[model samples]
Target: MIFAIIIGMSLATMIPRVIPAFIVDKLQFREWVNRWLNAIPYAALGALIFPGVTTVKPDEPHIGLIGGIVAIILAYIGLNVILVVIGAIAAVFLLSI
Candidate 1:
């Protein structure tokens, strides 16, 4: 069933994040990891932004524009995730009207 598959994948993912610590203790590596590891977050951020900024709906503001810029600033300040999401929603609501 789909549920089984989901559980299997969830465990598989959980294993890798935790397994590295144990495995690394058993081995040694002098070489650095692929830089792609570090870039994924920023790359994902851009992926989310590009379309949002380029496409505008009657109710939605352009991504990376004023609302998006404000969201980015709030995020940069490390605001709570729930608050950030709510703030972004408020911004959209206000700007759309």
Candidate 2:
């Protein structure tokens, strides 16, 4: 019974997702629409990460802000992503100390 319920739930979840991929595969979007679609992941990532960045320390929110600023500057300077993330982590760690 448990196995049957799990299989039913999996099918219900997969059907909606799998159907869209098959349906959209044959469709051609405009160039601008394609560009917008490509940007969705980054936009979604920022929306998700920004809140966590701001609340890293409830009493001292500025530490998180400073870390975010460091990350932005490193990214703007074209540093590697790993370096940018490490720099941000280091900034926050130092500030907390």
Candidate 3:
């Protein structure tokens, strides 16, 4: 039935994520490994954001570039993520206008 299919899909999506956390919790990582893992999120974020930066405003990449630069500077200065995102959007909107 539809309910059973939905449950199955949810379990399929969750199990992979849940199993890794549980398994990794049981293992002890070396200092280098921990440092590498700590860097993963930042690296992933940059990877995700870089492309969007280039394509955010296809008609005017300059606006996106300006926004992205502001976002990066705000982030580097340890601003909150929400503020950084808001600042970037505001910059882009103002520049576009």
Candidate 4:
């Protein structure tokens, strides 16, 4: 029963992601639509990050703010995403300690 349930859960999670790539690949999008679609990841990242940026440290919100600023600056300077995240984490860690 547990094994079957795990397989069922995996299939349920996989289907949505797998079906979309197949469907999207067969469709033609306009230039503007493609541009909008490309921006989705950035938008999603910002949505996920902003809340944490503002409240990562409850007692001292400034650490999060500093880390967020470091991330933004690194990203704007064309650093890789991993580097930007590492810079943010480093800033927060150093400041918090």
Per lDDT, the best of the predicted structures is 2
Model 3 alpha-carbon drift over 4 Å, by segment: 1-13, 75-80
Q: Using alpha carbons, what is the TM-score of model 2?
A: 0.64
Q: TM-score for model 3?
A: 0.63
Scored by lDDT, model 1 comes in at: 0.73
Candidate 1: tens digits of C-alpha lDDT, residues 1-97: 9999999999989998998778867765444644665677999989988766645463544632666677777889999878777887787668778
Instruction: Report the lDDT tens digits of candidate 2 across residue range 1-92.
Output: 99999999999999998996888988899999999999999999999878788898988888999999999999999999999999999999
Better of 2 and 3 by lDDT: 2
In order of appearance, the predictions have TM-scores of 0.51, 0.64, 0.63, 0.61
Better of 1 and 3 by lDDT: 3
Give the residue spans of candidate 4 off by over 4 A.
1-9, 30-32, 58-61, 77-83
Model 3 residue 87 lDDT score: 95
- Candidate 3 residues 1-97, lDDT tens each? 9999999999999999889777987899999999999999999988988777878878877788889899889999999999999999998888877
TM-score-wise, the better of 2 and 4 is 2
Who wins the TM-score comparison? 2
